[model samples]
Target: MALALNDKVLTEVYGPSTGTALRIKQVAMVVLGIAVLAIAAKIKVPVPGSPVAMNMGTFAVLTIGAAYGPRLGLTTILGYMIVGMLGFDIFQSSTADLNGINYMMGSTGGYLVGYVLATLALGFAARAGWDRSMGKMALAMLLGNVIIYLPGVAWLGVLYGFDQPILQWGLTPFLIGDALKLALAALLLPAIWKLVGDARK
Candidate 1:
């Protein structure tokens, strides 16, 4: 069995560089994380027969959560949301007309909210040693991915209707994509850790 690595990927990758350098690195990581989330959100695929699109935002969320610890991960996600709310086209569901607070109150707002929860959930798990091995990382990613749909489906259902069809439209269509993303993230983290550890030695 592999021993648990440190929860924060930056700290692990860069060695124990201290003081202002570490703080700068952490701040840069948070900003980069937000940029990553935005980039992932932009990779949108229109799902046929559903209003909800398949996007890699959750995948990025999982990756960032696993890399950053809870506090930093949560802060990073919140920063992403704030950026979106401030009229940036950083959100996956961003529209030409509705870019600011309007988008938040729009249909995809709940999933937007769920992003924070997913980050916190996965962040906590990563910090607690779930990010070390493939099996545990996969489980943590799966849980994190699933929780995103709670608010997603709820908000979607409320905006549309409280019916099975609506639920299916909001969630069922994305399960396969989410599973693939989860598996990718699970494998990706371990691979990154292995590569980084080897490089440092």
Candidate 2:
């Protein structure tokens, strides 16, 4: 259940190489993860009253983490967040349309923050080799979603206060979508692994 330092999906697919080569590949993967996340952020459905948009961002988060493993995955997540903070329009429409620190102060900020935590939680799970199988990855993805939602709900509750219920503003609207995303991820990760396996043979 533990991933050796080099036991990540990409590492498995490509096989081990010199430290320099690995470093180069890791950097490239991080950049690619950021790009994919930016694209995922754009695919969204606006939820009324609530600042949080339903987006594929979470799916990209867990998928990237599972692919990149803990260390590189964390680097990529933090990079994505920071770049958005620098006004890259990297967030979903709700926040991407926003500028500077204002977006973080927006209703969607908590969820964005949740993306960071969720990526870490799932990345760690990936480091534990959870990505190698569908069931374990499903659990890892569900847990990752929880990690995203908790801070999201808390931040939403604090920002809006008692004026709106946190569930309405943040949590309740996205449950089904998140479930669907999780199921898709469960299948996707193992399929990618299988493809990689087939390629190497």
Give the number of the best model, judged by lDDT. 1
Off by over 4 Å in 2: 1-6, 94-97, 198-201
Per-residue accuracy of model 1 over 13-73 as CA lDDT, tens digit each: 5744588877887788889999999999999999887777899998999888878868889
Clash count (model 2, backbone only): 0
Counting clashing residue pairs in each candidate, in order, gives 0, 0
lDDT per prediction? 0.82, 0.81
Candidate 2 RMSD to the real structure: 2.7
Which portions of model 1 miss their true places by more than 4 Å? Answer: 1-12, 15-17, 198-201
Task: Name every residue pair that clashes in candidate 1.
Answer: none
Across residues 96-153, which tens digit of lDDT does each residue of candidate 2 receive? Answer: 4575578877777777787887887777777676776999999999899898888888
